[model samples]
Structures are given as C-alpha cells and as structure tokens.
Target: MTKYYFLLFLFLLAGESFAQNNLDSLVQIRGFAIAAPRPDGLPDFIKFVNEELAPRKVNTLILRVDYNYRFESHPELRDSVTLSKKDVRKLVDACKKQGIAIIPQINLLGHQSWAEKTENLLKVYPDFDETPWVKMPAKGEYKWPNPDGLYCKSYCPLHPGVHKVVFELVDEIMEAFEAKAFHAGMDEVFYLGEDKCPRCAGRDKAVLFANEVQKIRDHLAMKNQELWIWGDRLIDGRTTGIGLWAASYNHTYPAIDLIPRDVIICDWQYTRDNQTAVYFAMKGLRVVTCSWNRPEIALQQVDSHVRSRDLSNKELKGRFYGLAHTVWSGPTPFLKGYYANTQDPKDGDKTPWNTFKVMFEKIGKLETGH
Candidate 1:
C-alpha cells in the first residue's frame, strides 16, 4: 500500500507539470504599460489598478519609473516629484493583492533628454553623455534632421563609471517594487559609437549595444531576475524599410543575435500592423507585442499574438509570450480621460485610453472564450 501511494504521487505530479506547461503555452502576459504616478496621484493610480486592471486580468504592469522614485542609494538622481518608499509600498501592495506582476522601468542607454531639457542622469553626471558636443536647443523644441542629428541623447555604454550608478538605481527600484523583472528602456538609441567619443569611437555599434544588454541581464541574473527591453533597436531599418523610429538605422540591429536570449523584448508598432514579434520569437527571444494609440492596429496585434501562439511549434509558441498596451502619458491624465470617456474629435479612435479599453476587453473575452 505504501508503494502504491508513492506511485500515485508521481503520477499526479507529472499531470500537474503537464497542465502548467499547457497553460504557459497560451498568452502568459496581459500587460499595461504606463508611467509611474506622482506621489500625490498614488492613491488614484492604486484605485485604478484595483478597479480597472484587476477586472481585466492585467497580469503585468510596466511602470516607467525613470528617475521618479526617491532612491536612498542615489538621492541626487531623484526627480522633483517622486514616489517615496511608503508610496511605492501602497502601489506594490495593491498590485500584489490583485496578482499583478510589477516591472519597474528606468530609461538606461537612451531617452536621456527631451527637447531642450536634459534628464536627471546626464544632468547629475555630464561626463557620461555619449555626444557631449550635441547641445540641446536653447529656446524652442529640438527638431529632427537637425545639424547635430539628435533625437534623444544616450550615455556612452563604455563609460567606466556609468553602470555603477545605473545598477544602483536598478537594484533600489527593483527592491522597492519587489519586482522579478527590470525593464531597462533601451529604445530608440540613435547616438551610439560616435566618432568623437573617446571610448566608443570607431567601435562596433552592435557590440556596444549587445554588451550593455548582456551586462544588465547578467546583473539581474544574480538575483534570478529577468531583463526586459524595447525591440526597436534590434531591427534592420534600412533593409526592412520600417524606418529609423520603429527600427534601427545605426547598424545596431545585428545586436539581436548577440544579446542573451532570455531577455524579453517589447516590440512596439503604432501606425500599422508590423509583424516583427515573429522575428524576435524566431530568433529565440520571448517577445510581447506592444501597441499605442491605434485601436485597430492594437486589435490586430491581439489577434496576431493569439494566432502566433496557436499556430507555432511548441518551441516557438511560448516565445510569442503576449500583448501589451502602452500609454505614453502619465497615469493621472490617462485615468481622468479613461473614466470621463474623454475623446478628442481630432484623434477619433486614435487614443491610448481607447486602445487600452479595446485591447483588454478583447483579451478578457478571448481568455474566457466569450
């Protein structure tokens, strides 16, 4: 009888493992991407997570924390309006109660500045700037195709002291959110391997980008955590004709093969149905299809995600992990618009709030078979 019971236990454990694997084959991450709320707006954001996100089954919440948190390790990098540890705990508790995984983001290699204003990292340590010669516009907004060819600034990946400061911020933010994954916003990196920079000059752009990704991934691996990044910089812009914004033009696309496969890529395309998720998946990386402000395209992305998972081989199906709706604005304005049903005549159906609703409603129906 004791031997019979032992055999039965083994049989049940095998069944459970198979069931879990079957479930994992489907869309595993129903995500919502938004900026971290200010300290004052924390309550409302928490309420939204409880009321809106929970009901729709948003399992993954990627909050763009950037420099918006009060860091004990580097208090100098804190933004003027930031979330305190107390504030972070409230948000974390709300998410934990709802079974939502929180992934905190800090823009690492790129997006260091917007228009004329420099971001906190470069402002604090100016020596890290990859293109120190490319100055921001003094008066009006920075224009594209400018003399400096600037879109957003990037820090030199080879800078000796850069990772120490950034990794400190990463560790602190991950600890505060109790996150299993860290989203390093390494997207739209236009300024890399510049000729003028001492360390990175004449070096291979793809290697520089890949090395940085590996470094971040290795750091997270120490704690058995994962690294997530935007997929734009990994596409061959010139060959694919996906253009510079959505893909890479600076020859960094080849880095796709060099980086660790465990890194999750958030492949975003707003205007049209760009089926680049397949590219990432085929390349042995798990990818989430990200959409912004286009409900039609967002719905298509949802269908694509489901279809890819359903049709692909077992090896590739799980790599097409899920879909995420990205909100480019802050939580306060977005939540206000979402609740009020606010729509501009000019935008029509092209709004992130509208896409958020449509995307999740479709996800809810798909998951339930309704």
Candidate 2:
C-alpha cells in the first residue's frame, strides 16, 4: 500500500508541472478594445463577437462603457441612448460562451469634456471640474493651443464628493457586465493640481495622480478585480521625446514609481513604434502595447511584443503581456467599415479598421504557431 501511494504522488506531481508549463507557453492575452454598442446595435455586436472575434482567438474584450449604460445608482449620469441590463447581459453571455474576458471601462479623472462639450459627470456636477475657470468654447469655436490651454477636462482628484459618486457607478457597471477587470481611462490627463482649484491648488501632481490610481486600485482589489489604465500618464514626454499626446509633458510621470505595480498599463502609440513597453516592463509593471489607426505600426508592435517575450528571461518576459488594437469610433460605424472593406478617403490606409484586421490576423497566426 505504501509503495503504491508513493508512485501515485509522483505521477500527480509530474502532471501538475506539465499543466503549468503548457499554460506558460501560450500567449497570456489576445485583446481587442472598442466602444460598447448601443442597445439597438447589440445583436450585430454579439454576432461579430461569435463569428469574427472567436475565430481569431480574441480572449479579451475591453468595452468603453463610459456613461453609455442606464444607471440605477446615478440616474442623472445615464446617456440619452444607453444599454439596459438586458443589453449588457447579451454581451456578457456572448463573451462568456466564446471564453473571452469582458472588461468594462469608464473614463475616470480625465476625459470629462471633449472639443467644446462637457461630458455627463462634470455637466451634472459642475463643482468637480479641475479647471472650472477655463470655460469650454462654443460648438464650432474650439481649437487646439488656445490661450486657456484646454484639451480635455479632468475632475479634481481631491474633491471629497467625487469618489462617492464615481464608486457607485463603478460598482453598478462592473456588476452589470459581470467583469473581473475594470479599465479606468486615465490617459492624457493634462489638467491636474492646477493653481486655481480651491482644494488641489498646490499639491504634487504625481502624488495626486498616484493617489487616485491607488484609490481606484484598492477599491477594485477589495473585490479581487484588476485595474487597468493607459500608460501615457506614467511616461515622461520631455525625456522620451514621444511628446505630450502619446506620453506625458506634465510632471505626473513620477507616478510610475509611486503607483502600485499590479496596475496594468495600456501603452499606446499611433504613428511609430515607441518601444516604451520595454520601459514599463523594466519598471516592474505588466504592459500591453496598444495601437490605433496605423496598420504598419500595429504590425510592428506585434512583432516587438513577441520578440520581447522570446528574448527576455522568465522574470521579465511575463511583463510583456500582449497587444490590444483600439478603435476610437462607435461600434456601429466600425462594424460598417469593417464589413464593407472600405477605408476613409481622408484617412486612406491609416484607418483603425485596416489596423484591426491586419493586427488580429497576425495575432491569429501567432496563436496557431504559424
């Protein structure tokens, strides 16, 4: 009996080791990101998920669900056209059947306003605006490099009432999607720690940024969900020469060291292969290279990500998570362009639909070991 038990133990140990090795060999994540479909468009979106995404082995879908859902917790914040619980369930069911992880995103802190219009949160609660002094321009009067230096508006991180409302929405949305991860869109945060704000006037921008990131991360951690954010705010624009849009010109880059290591960074670059993924990995954070509207650059990003994993040691290789193709347009328009196989005359080959097809095809080939 003793001899038989010893043999069984050895067999189990060998089986466990083999399973671990197999998992480690496979790509960690194959992801696609886009805006969530409107309620009327859910059927087509689900069909795309079942037919296109599943065949290509996309295991992760990040839907930008910012203010697009019917919120019970905060009814005032709901968009005119929104996803009901039933609509969210359809998406959830589709992704679950395909073995894809669905992560819902809300643009937090920054992206409170666009060109000349304010988004829901700040519109409903005017006191949350980080730069309330700089008024938004009229509909057609908005331009870059204006005297106000306005790009997108950010909510004051130090506002006491901010998180109370934000957290409620976060919880409601996460529950609706049944998501295990939440993407807080914290990219291109230009206004932080501005001198005019009553509460946040002279605070360190890096500390403020890190504090907000850590707060969100900690809140999610309680439920054991992960927090993902864009990597641009954590990168130094001046030193890297990647400039303000792709990286950060504000002093918040130091937040890279201050923020928790577990936060996943979506490092995005459009026109060129920035190689900033390596920097993130070196900083002891897992990073996914994100691309938009540039097929060539997207392809290069895939090659670079694969190579990074192949060449690095075990300690560093895992930090090079994978690549995510980002679509900036609405789901309906993107689907129309994708099915029609048409490119924007103005954008030509520099369209997100083109990049999406090319990048994912490469990813599919890689997954098959072809």
Q: Each model's TM-score?
A: 0.93, 0.93
For residue 78, give model 2's deviation from the true position in Å: 0.4
Model 2 whole-model lDDT (C-alpha atoms): 0.91
Winner by lDDT: 1
> Taking the tens digit of each residue's C-alpha lDDT, what string does model 1 give over 237-328?
88988999999999999999999999999999888888999999999999999988989999999889888888899899889988899999
lDDT (Cα, tens digit) per residue for candidate 2, span 1-370? 9999999999989886765444335457778999999988999999999999988778899999999999999999999999999889889998999999999999999999999999999999999999999999999999999999899999999999999999999999999999999999999999999999999888999999999999999999999999999999998999999999988898999999999999999989888998999999999999989989989999999889888988899999999987888999788999998998887788787788889889988876764457
What candidate 1 gets wrong by more than 4 Å, as runs, is: 1-25
lDDT at residue 83 of model 1 (Cα atoms): 94
For each candidate, what is the lDDT?
0.92, 0.91
Query: Which ten-residue region of model 2 has the weakest summed lDDT?
Result: 18-27
